[model samples]
Target: MVNSFISGLAGPLKPDLEMMAICKVSIPGLKTGKEQTSEVKRGRDPIFNQEFFFDHVTIEDLDTKNVSITAFHHGGAKLGKDLLIGEAVVPLREIRELNAKKEVKVIEEIKQAIPK
Candidate 1:
Protein backbone atom coordinates (compact mmCIF):
# COMPACT_ATOMS: atom_id res chain seq x y z
CA MET A 1 0.00 0.00 0.00
CA VAL A 2 1.14 3.51 -0.82
CA ASN A 3 -0.05 6.63 0.90
CA SER A 4 0.10 9.94 -0.94
CA PHE A 5 -0.71 13.43 0.13
CA ILE A 6 -0.98 16.63 -1.90
CA SER A 7 -0.29 19.22 0.72
CA GLY A 8 -0.58 22.35 -1.41
CA LEU A 9 0.26 24.13 -4.66
CA ALA A 10 2.11 27.34 -5.49
CA GLY A 11 3.13 29.56 -8.43
CA PRO A 12 0.59 28.81 -11.11
CA LEU A 13 1.57 30.06 -14.56
CA LYS A 14 -1.35 31.83 -16.03
CA PRO A 15 -1.91 30.98 -19.69
CA ASP A 16 -4.10 33.99 -20.35
CA LEU A 17 -3.55 37.47 -19.05
CA GLU A 18 -7.20 38.03 -18.17
CA MET A 19 -8.14 34.71 -16.64
CA MET A 20 -8.41 33.71 -13.03
CA ALA A 21 -6.42 30.60 -12.17
CA ILE A 22 -7.65 27.54 -10.33
CA CYS A 23 -5.56 24.50 -9.61
CA LYS A 24 -6.01 20.78 -8.97
CA VAL A 25 -3.97 17.60 -8.72
CA SER A 26 -4.74 14.41 -10.63
CA ILE A 27 -3.33 10.93 -10.21
CA PRO A 28 -4.52 8.30 -12.63
CA GLY A 29 -4.78 4.65 -11.71
CA LEU A 30 -7.24 1.98 -10.68
CA LYS A 31 -10.52 3.11 -9.18
CA THR A 32 -9.10 3.04 -5.69
CA GLY A 33 -5.92 4.85 -6.64
CA LYS A 34 -7.28 7.57 -8.84
CA GLU A 35 -7.71 10.89 -7.04
CA GLN A 36 -7.74 14.66 -7.55
CA THR A 37 -7.53 17.71 -5.34
CA SER A 38 -10.29 20.23 -4.93
CA GLU A 39 -10.07 23.25 -7.22
CA VAL A 40 -8.54 26.43 -5.89
CA LYS A 41 -10.12 29.62 -7.06
CA ARG A 42 -8.88 32.91 -8.54
CA GLY A 43 -5.22 33.26 -7.86
CA ARG A 44 -1.74 32.85 -9.31
CA ASP A 45 -0.88 30.76 -6.32
CA PRO A 46 -3.31 28.21 -4.89
CA ILE A 47 -3.14 25.79 -2.05
CA PHE A 48 -4.73 22.36 -1.89
CA ASN A 49 -4.39 20.21 1.16
CA GLN A 50 -5.52 16.75 0.11
CA GLU A 51 -4.61 13.12 0.64
CA PHE A 52 -4.85 9.86 -1.29
CA PHE A 53 -4.06 6.25 -0.67
CA PHE A 54 -3.26 3.42 -3.07
CA ASP A 55 -3.73 -0.08 -1.77
CA HIS A 56 -1.85 -3.05 -3.22
CA VAL A 57 0.63 -0.91 -5.13
CA THR A 58 3.79 -2.89 -5.70
CA ILE A 59 7.35 -1.84 -6.46
CA GLU A 60 6.91 -2.81 -10.08
CA ASP A 61 3.82 -0.68 -10.27
CA LEU A 62 5.68 2.21 -8.71
CA ASP A 63 8.35 1.96 -11.37
CA THR A 64 5.71 2.42 -14.05
CA LYS A 65 3.28 4.72 -12.29
CA ASN A 66 3.46 8.47 -12.11
CA VAL A 67 1.69 11.18 -10.13
CA SER A 68 0.46 14.07 -12.20
CA ILE A 69 -0.13 17.48 -10.66
CA THR A 70 -1.87 20.04 -12.77
CA ALA A 71 -2.99 23.65 -12.64
CA PHE A 72 -5.98 24.93 -14.56
CA HIS A 73 -7.72 28.23 -15.17
CA HIS A 74 -11.45 28.30 -14.53
CA GLY A 75 -13.28 30.53 -16.96
CA GLY A 76 -16.28 32.31 -15.56
CA ALA A 77 -19.86 31.79 -16.72
CA LYS A 78 -19.27 34.06 -19.68
CA LEU A 79 -16.35 32.04 -20.99
CA GLY A 80 -17.02 28.36 -20.46
CA LYS A 81 -13.56 27.04 -21.30
CA ASP A 82 -10.99 25.91 -18.82
CA LEU A 83 -7.33 26.42 -19.64
CA LEU A 84 -4.39 24.39 -18.47
CA ILE A 85 -1.51 26.23 -16.84
CA GLY A 86 1.10 23.60 -16.06
CA GLU A 87 1.73 20.10 -14.75
CA ALA A 88 4.40 17.93 -13.25
CA VAL A 89 4.83 14.18 -13.66
CA VAL A 90 6.49 12.61 -10.67
CA PRO A 91 7.67 9.04 -11.11
CA LEU A 92 7.27 6.84 -8.07
CA ARG A 93 10.27 4.54 -8.50
CA GLU A 94 12.60 6.61 -6.41
CA ILE A 95 9.95 7.30 -3.83
CA ARG A 96 9.22 3.61 -3.56
CA GLU A 97 12.87 2.81 -3.06
CA LEU A 98 13.27 5.44 -0.42
CA ASN A 99 10.18 4.24 1.38
CA ALA A 100 11.46 0.70 1.33
CA LYS A 101 14.51 1.71 3.29
CA LYS A 102 12.87 3.64 6.14
CA GLU A 103 9.36 4.74 5.25
CA VAL A 104 10.42 7.94 3.60
CA LYS A 105 8.15 10.95 3.53
CA VAL A 106 8.98 13.37 0.78
CA ILE A 107 7.69 16.76 -0.26
CA GLU A 108 8.85 17.58 -3.76
CA GLU A 109 8.68 20.96 -5.42
CA ILE A 110 8.39 20.41 -9.14
CA LYS A 111 8.12 22.83 -12.06
CA GLN A 112 7.50 21.58 -15.56
CA ALA A 113 5.46 22.10 -18.70
CA ILE A 114 2.01 20.68 -19.24
CA PRO A 115 1.80 17.78 -21.66
CA LYS A 116 0.13 18.33 -25.01
Candidate 2:
Protein backbone atom coordinates (compact mmCIF):
# COMPACT_ATOMS: atom_id res chain seq x y z
CA MET A 1 0.00 0.00 0.00
CA VAL A 2 1.04 3.65 -0.54
CA ASN A 3 0.82 4.41 3.21
CA SER A 4 3.34 1.69 4.14
CA PHE A 5 5.91 2.85 1.53
CA ILE A 6 6.17 6.33 3.10
CA SER A 7 5.54 5.41 6.75
CA GLY A 8 9.17 5.56 8.05
CA LEU A 9 10.62 7.81 5.29
CA ALA A 10 12.37 11.03 6.36
CA GLY A 11 11.86 14.60 5.02
CA PRO A 12 14.40 14.60 2.17
CA LEU A 13 13.59 10.97 1.25
CA LYS A 14 9.88 11.69 1.23
CA PRO A 15 8.55 13.62 -1.80
CA ASP A 16 7.52 17.21 -1.02
CA LEU A 17 4.48 17.09 -3.34
CA GLU A 18 2.17 14.07 -3.20
CA MET A 19 -1.39 13.16 -4.24
CA MET A 20 -1.61 14.49 -7.79
CA ALA A 21 -5.25 15.37 -8.43
CA ILE A 22 -7.03 14.39 -11.65
CA CYS A 23 -10.00 16.72 -11.09
CA LYS A 24 -11.09 19.96 -9.37
CA VAL A 25 -14.14 21.78 -8.07
CA SER A 26 -14.68 25.50 -7.38
CA ILE A 27 -16.93 24.84 -4.43
CA PRO A 28 -17.38 21.47 -2.65
CA GLY A 29 -20.97 20.66 -3.73
CA LEU A 30 -22.52 23.74 -5.33
CA LYS A 31 -23.09 23.21 -9.04
CA THR A 32 -23.62 20.48 -11.63
CA GLY A 33 -22.83 20.84 -15.35
CA LYS A 34 -24.42 24.27 -15.47
CA GLU A 35 -23.67 27.93 -16.20
CA GLN A 36 -23.78 30.31 -13.23
CA THR A 37 -23.33 34.09 -13.44
CA SER A 38 -21.71 36.26 -10.79
CA GLU A 39 -20.42 39.81 -10.55
CA VAL A 40 -16.78 40.96 -10.80
CA LYS A 41 -15.62 44.40 -9.65
CA ARG A 42 -12.24 46.10 -10.29
CA GLY A 43 -10.47 47.50 -7.27
CA ARG A 44 -9.18 51.15 -6.96
CA ASP A 45 -8.76 52.11 -10.66
CA PRO A 46 -12.09 50.61 -11.83
CA ILE A 47 -12.95 48.97 -15.21
CA PHE A 48 -15.82 48.55 -17.70
CA ASN A 49 -17.29 45.14 -16.84
CA GLN A 50 -19.24 44.33 -13.67
CA GLU A 51 -19.85 40.55 -14.10
CA PHE A 52 -18.66 37.32 -15.75
CA PHE A 53 -19.86 33.73 -16.00
CA PHE A 54 -18.36 31.33 -13.46
CA ASP A 55 -18.78 27.63 -14.26
CA HIS A 56 -19.35 25.28 -11.32
CA VAL A 57 -19.87 21.52 -11.54
CA THR A 58 -20.61 18.23 -9.75
CA ILE A 59 -19.31 15.00 -11.23
CA GLU A 60 -20.38 11.40 -11.94
CA ASP A 61 -17.37 9.54 -13.30
CA LEU A 62 -17.43 5.92 -14.40
CA ASP A 63 -13.66 6.15 -14.05
CA THR A 64 -14.00 7.05 -10.35
CA LYS A 65 -16.13 4.98 -7.97
CA ASN A 66 -15.22 6.78 -4.75
CA VAL A 67 -18.59 8.23 -3.66
CA SER A 68 -22.30 7.90 -4.12
CA ILE A 69 -23.72 11.40 -4.83
CA THR A 70 -27.51 11.58 -4.61
CA ALA A 71 -30.13 14.36 -4.16
CA PHE A 72 -28.30 16.53 -6.70
CA HIS A 73 -29.16 20.24 -7.10
CA HIS A 74 -30.50 20.95 -10.55
CA GLY A 75 -31.17 23.43 -13.41
CA GLY A 76 -29.08 26.19 -15.02
CA ALA A 77 -28.76 27.80 -18.44
CA LYS A 78 -26.06 26.66 -20.88
CA LEU A 79 -23.87 29.50 -22.13
CA GLY A 80 -22.28 29.61 -25.58
CA LYS A 81 -18.79 28.59 -24.61
CA ASP A 82 -16.72 25.52 -25.53
CA LEU A 83 -15.24 24.80 -22.13
CA LEU A 84 -15.75 21.27 -20.72
CA ILE A 85 -15.40 21.55 -16.93
CA GLY A 86 -16.89 18.16 -15.98
CA GLU A 87 -17.63 14.78 -17.51
CA ALA A 88 -19.93 11.72 -17.37
CA VAL A 89 -19.28 8.73 -19.62
CA VAL A 90 -21.31 5.60 -18.75
CA PRO A 91 -20.22 2.57 -20.75
CA LEU A 92 -22.81 0.60 -22.74
CA ARG A 93 -22.33 -2.66 -20.81
CA GLU A 94 -23.23 -1.15 -17.43
CA ILE A 95 -26.33 0.53 -18.84
CA ARG A 96 -27.45 -2.78 -20.35
CA GLU A 97 -26.90 -4.58 -17.05
CA LEU A 98 -29.00 -1.99 -15.19
CA ASN A 99 -31.78 -2.37 -17.72
CA ALA A 100 -31.75 -6.14 -17.24
CA LYS A 101 -32.02 -5.78 -13.46
CA LYS A 102 -34.86 -3.25 -13.48
CA GLU A 103 -38.50 -4.25 -14.02
CA VAL A 104 -39.35 -1.06 -15.92
CA LYS A 105 -36.46 0.62 -17.74
CA VAL A 106 -35.77 4.18 -18.80
CA ILE A 107 -32.46 4.67 -20.56
CA GLU A 108 -31.07 7.37 -22.78
CA GLU A 109 -29.29 5.88 -25.78
CA ILE A 110 -26.98 8.33 -27.57
CA LYS A 111 -25.41 5.83 -30.00
CA GLN A 112 -28.77 4.75 -31.40
CA ALA A 113 -29.69 8.35 -32.31
CA ILE A 114 -27.49 8.32 -35.40
CA PRO A 115 -28.63 6.31 -38.41
CA LYS A 116 -26.19 4.10 -40.32
Candidate 3:
Protein backbone atom coordinates (compact mmCIF):
# COMPACT_ATOMS: atom_id res chain seq x y z
CA MET A 1 0.00 0.00 0.00
CA VAL A 2 1.08 3.56 -0.74
CA ASN A 3 0.27 6.06 2.00
CA SER A 4 1.78 9.43 1.13
CA PHE A 5 4.58 11.49 -0.43
CA ILE A 6 6.60 14.33 1.02
CA SER A 7 8.83 16.28 -1.33
CA GLY A 8 12.28 17.39 -0.31
CA LEU A 9 13.97 20.75 -0.75
CA ALA A 10 14.43 21.73 -4.38
CA GLY A 11 17.74 20.87 -5.99
CA PRO A 12 19.38 21.67 -9.32
CA LEU A 13 17.79 18.67 -11.00
CA LYS A 14 15.01 17.82 -8.60
CA PRO A 15 12.63 20.61 -7.76
CA ASP A 16 9.82 20.52 -5.23
CA LEU A 17 7.25 19.31 -7.72
CA GLU A 18 3.96 17.48 -8.08
CA MET A 19 4.19 13.74 -8.49
CA MET A 20 2.70 10.27 -8.08
CA ALA A 21 3.92 7.00 -6.63
CA ILE A 22 4.01 3.32 -7.59
CA CYS A 23 4.63 0.24 -5.50
CA LYS A 24 6.16 -2.93 -6.86
CA VAL A 25 6.76 -6.33 -5.26
CA SER A 26 8.89 -9.13 -6.56
CA ILE A 27 9.91 -12.61 -5.55
CA PRO A 28 13.47 -13.09 -6.81
CA GLY A 29 12.83 -16.64 -7.93
CA LEU A 30 9.18 -16.10 -8.70
CA LYS A 31 7.53 -13.14 -10.44
CA THR A 32 7.43 -9.34 -10.47
CA GLY A 33 4.34 -7.20 -9.86
CA LYS A 34 3.50 -3.49 -9.65
CA GLU A 35 0.77 -1.02 -8.65
CA GLN A 36 0.38 2.78 -8.94
CA THR A 37 -1.43 5.65 -7.29
CA SER A 38 -3.14 8.66 -8.88
CA GLU A 39 -1.14 11.83 -9.48
CA VAL A 40 -1.42 14.55 -6.86
CA LYS A 41 -1.47 17.75 -8.83
CA ARG A 42 0.93 20.53 -7.80
CA GLY A 43 1.48 19.01 -4.43
CA ARG A 44 4.67 18.96 -2.40
CA ASP A 45 2.91 16.70 0.01
CA PRO A 46 0.40 14.17 -1.25
CA ILE A 47 -1.67 11.48 0.36
CA PHE A 48 -2.63 8.21 -1.27
CA ASN A 49 -4.94 5.70 0.30
CA GLN A 50 -4.15 2.72 -1.80
CA GLU A 51 -3.49 -0.96 -1.30
CA PHE A 52 -2.22 -3.87 -3.37
CA PHE A 53 -2.63 -7.61 -3.04
CA PHE A 54 -0.84 -10.59 -4.50
CA ASP A 55 -2.44 -14.00 -4.92
CA HIS A 56 -0.83 -17.41 -4.61
CA VAL A 57 2.11 -16.00 -2.72
CA THR A 58 3.31 -17.58 0.49
CA ILE A 59 5.22 -16.23 3.47
CA GLU A 60 8.18 -18.38 2.52
CA ASP A 61 8.27 -16.72 -0.89
CA LEU A 62 8.43 -13.32 0.74
CA ASP A 63 11.54 -14.18 2.74
CA THR A 64 13.67 -13.71 -0.37
CA LYS A 65 11.52 -11.08 -2.04
CA ASN A 66 11.61 -7.30 -2.20
CA VAL A 67 9.21 -4.37 -2.38
CA SER A 68 10.00 -1.13 -4.20
CA ILE A 69 8.00 2.05 -4.12
CA THR A 70 8.91 4.73 -6.66
CA ALA A 71 7.78 8.28 -7.18
CA PHE A 72 7.48 9.99 -10.56
CA HIS A 73 6.85 13.44 -11.99
CA HIS A 74 5.08 13.77 -15.30
CA GLY A 75 6.60 15.89 -18.06
CA GLY A 76 3.58 16.67 -20.17
CA ALA A 77 2.23 14.08 -22.61
CA LYS A 78 5.60 13.59 -24.20
CA LEU A 79 6.95 10.07 -24.40
CA GLY A 80 9.83 8.96 -22.23
CA LYS A 81 10.00 12.27 -20.43
CA ASP A 82 8.84 11.31 -16.97
CA LEU A 83 11.12 12.31 -14.10
CA LEU A 84 12.06 9.90 -11.32
CA ILE A 85 11.59 11.50 -7.93
CA GLY A 86 12.79 8.65 -5.71
CA GLU A 87 12.35 5.05 -4.66
CA ALA A 88 12.36 2.91 -1.51
CA VAL A 89 13.33 -0.76 -1.48
CA VAL A 90 12.16 -2.90 1.41
CA PRO A 91 13.39 -6.39 2.11
CA LEU A 92 10.62 -8.82 3.00
CA ARG A 93 12.66 -10.11 5.91
CA GLU A 94 11.58 -7.03 7.84
CA ILE A 95 7.94 -7.84 7.16
CA ARG A 96 8.42 -11.48 8.01
CA GLU A 97 9.97 -10.53 11.32
CA LEU A 98 7.06 -8.29 12.13
CA ASN A 99 4.61 -11.02 11.22
CA ALA A 100 6.48 -13.55 13.32
CA LYS A 101 6.17 -11.24 16.29
CA LYS A 102 2.42 -10.85 15.63
CA GLU A 103 2.78 -7.20 14.82
CA VAL A 104 1.30 -7.29 11.33
CA LYS A 105 -1.25 -4.64 12.17
CA VAL A 106 1.22 -2.27 13.77
CA ILE A 107 1.65 1.06 12.05
CA GLU A 108 5.29 1.65 11.26
CA GLU A 109 6.72 4.55 9.39
CA ILE A 110 9.92 4.28 7.41
CA LYS A 111 11.67 7.41 6.28
CA GLN A 112 13.69 7.23 3.09
CA ALA A 113 15.23 10.15 1.24
CA ILE A 114 14.72 10.51 -2.47
CA PRO A 115 17.70 9.59 -4.60
CA LYS A 116 19.41 12.55 -6.22
The segments of candidate 2 whose C-alpha lies over 4 angstroms from its true place after superposition are 1-82, 96-101, 104-116
lDDT for position 33 in model 3: 52
Pairs that collide in candidate 2 are: none
lDDT of each: 0.53, 0.24, 0.48
Q: Which runs of model 3 end up more than 4 angstroms from their true locations?
A: 1-38, 78-80, 96-116
lDDT of 3 by residue, 11-71 (tens): 3434554444332333334453544345556655555444445444445555566666666
Native-vs-model 1 lDDT? Answer: 0.53
Native-to-model Cα distance after best TM-score fit, residue 16 in candidate 2, in Å: 29
| Runs in model 1 lying further than 4 Å from the true structure | 1-22, 29-31, 96-116
Best by lDDT: 1
Query: lDDT score of model 3?
Result: 0.48
lDDT of 3 at 13: 36
